[model samples]
Target: MPTPPRVLTIAGSDSGGGAGIQADLKTMLALGVHGMSVIAAVTAQNSLGVQGYWELPPVAVRAQLDSVLSDIGTQAVKTGMLASTVLVETVAEVLADVTVPIIVDPVGVSKHGDSLLAPDALDAVRSVLLPLATVVTPNLWEVEQLTGIKVDEENRLRDAAEAVRALGPEWVLIKGGHLPGEPVDLLFDGTSEYRFAAARHDNRHTHGTGCTLASAIASHLALGSDVVEAVGRAKEYVTGAIEHGFPLGEGIGPVDHAWLQRR
Candidate 1:
């Protein structure tokens, strides 16, 4: 009777199920959207750290995208962890024709501090992928990687946001989770800027936060929420997720995806 909101994640696979495609799908489901995935790489990772990764061929990635977009028709698309420059370009090219909000999570590293994006792929992301993004969600490290701006203080957040917007994304959300004090994130849409603040949860199990935030934004955008509202809602969701985050392994565990269920 009603059309379900369709969302797609073109990203890597997390064998640990804490982040990557696993987190994207979980976040989409929590926000009442139909989730789909196109795996770009398969990672051997756990809470301890990333052990190894092998990227899928460009043809396989394209085939997955074509199959999904041809049938389900996505309302929004989110991308993360394009492991190589070739994969980055391939994803950008395939999604160029899709008329949906694109949430790009420039995943540069894992929660345990292992590199995700290759050194050579940075330029590809900056030149090819960012221009097509509806919203670019970058964590503090990613912002530094993309723009060479170090975010040390609150005022520096604006600088980071401005630097990211210069690359062509309609909006940029520079996550300030690494900054000291309350959890604060900066959102800039060229003309306007918004700051979203949440209580800094003292939890270490925050593995999937970036993936969850991007997918949550995609879900909200598909539901017709504006950039500011979508980001605000996404931040609130992530905050709650972090507050109830649980320990899964010896190292940092994952934010509880079933947080809403607990509440």
Candidate 2:
């Protein structure tokens, strides 16, 4: 049998199993890729919120990356929730030499409005990390966090994408789920632009949407899709997952990564 395409996720462990490393790996599996992880932090999280988180030492984080890249190499990588400057820099340094697709989620806050990325690490993300990304996926909130540009309406998405693109990523995907009306995401790479729209799923169980989308993109890239094709495919997968999102604990639940199999 042919070996499956390998994809690596460098992120935090979401104890809730909804977002972060858990979500990324689940999405990878659902998309038919071999998933690997380098846990940069551990979160005491649940559906309710992230109570607290602790970053792994930089040395340990580097060790995990080296172990994965040196032997069982990956075709693509996705990053989220580094939580500190050192962690971000450490990941960026190692990933700089990797000649594969890199998807950066730029996870700044949890679904419950809990802060995940530290205030100080924002600079490192802009300077060191994003430059090496094949695609940088940032929600409106994160756009403002990184570029001080607020995107309130659909027309402003291009502006947000441009601002983020200036920071160095080859492509920028601005997630507009937070806006009113049907969900629309703008994908821009300096000149070209593509818009993906999905029916607004009124499900409140949309916890892992960001992590899931980024991981799905990485999976498709590993499967040999270009940036545009990868993002398009990822959007479709995430839309189905969102439509099938099911309630779990007391608060918001997770998107069903197995929605395809279950259907």
Candidate 3:
């Protein structure tokens, strides 16, 4: 058998196996990519929410990254919750020289309204992390936190995308999942823009959508799709996952990462 395209996720671990590194790996597998992970933090999270999280030391984070990049170079890299200022800065620096595409999911809050990022790390996320992203995927809340731009209406997604693009990401994806209407996402690279819209699944058990989407993009990118194509494919996969989301643990359950295979 031919070797699958390797995709690496540098993020936190979710004990719930619903989000963070677990979601990333699952998405990558669904997309037919070899998934690897360098865990930056570990969160005590479940269907209910994140109870607590502990970030690995900067040195340990760096070692794991170096261990991966030095031996098995990846075709794409995805980033999720980095928790602290030092971790954010260190991850950015370590990934700076990477030649592959970097898909950054600016995960700010959990599905159950828990804060995962440190308050002081906002500046590091803006100054250090955003600039290094090949594609930055931020939800409405993350957009406001990172760029101070509020995306109230679907039409204003461009304004938010532009502001975020100015932060140095090659592409900016402003997610409109939280908006009133159908979930719409605006993808822009300053000169050109594309919009992807999907029927918002009414299922309230939609946890891990953000992490899954970004990882899907990385998986597609690793499989040789361009940024726009990757995002489009990812949207389709996530929409299906959301639609088929099953209830678990008496709270917001995770989207079915294996929805494709199960069908």
Name the lDDT of candidate 1.
0.93
User: Which runs in model 2 stand beyond 4 Å of their true positions?
Assistant: none
- In order, what lDDT does every prediction score? 0.93, 0.97, 0.93
User: lDDT tens string, model 1, 1-263?
Assistant: 79779999999999999999999999999888899999999999988999999999999999999999988889999999999999999999988999899999999999888999999999999999999999999998999999999998888999999999999999999999888888789999988999999998888899899999999999999988988899999999989999998998789899988899778
Q: Model 2: per-residue lDDT, tens digit, 194-220?
A: 999999987999999999999999999
Q: How badly does each model clash, as a count of residue pairs?
A: 0, 0, 0
Measured with C-alpha atoms, the lDDT of residue 209 in candidate 1 is 92
- RMSD (CA, Å), each prediction: 0.8, 0.5, 0.8
**Which number leads on lDDT?**
2
Worst lDDT 10-window in candidate 3: 199-208
Tell me model 3's lDDT, rounded to 2 decimals.
0.93
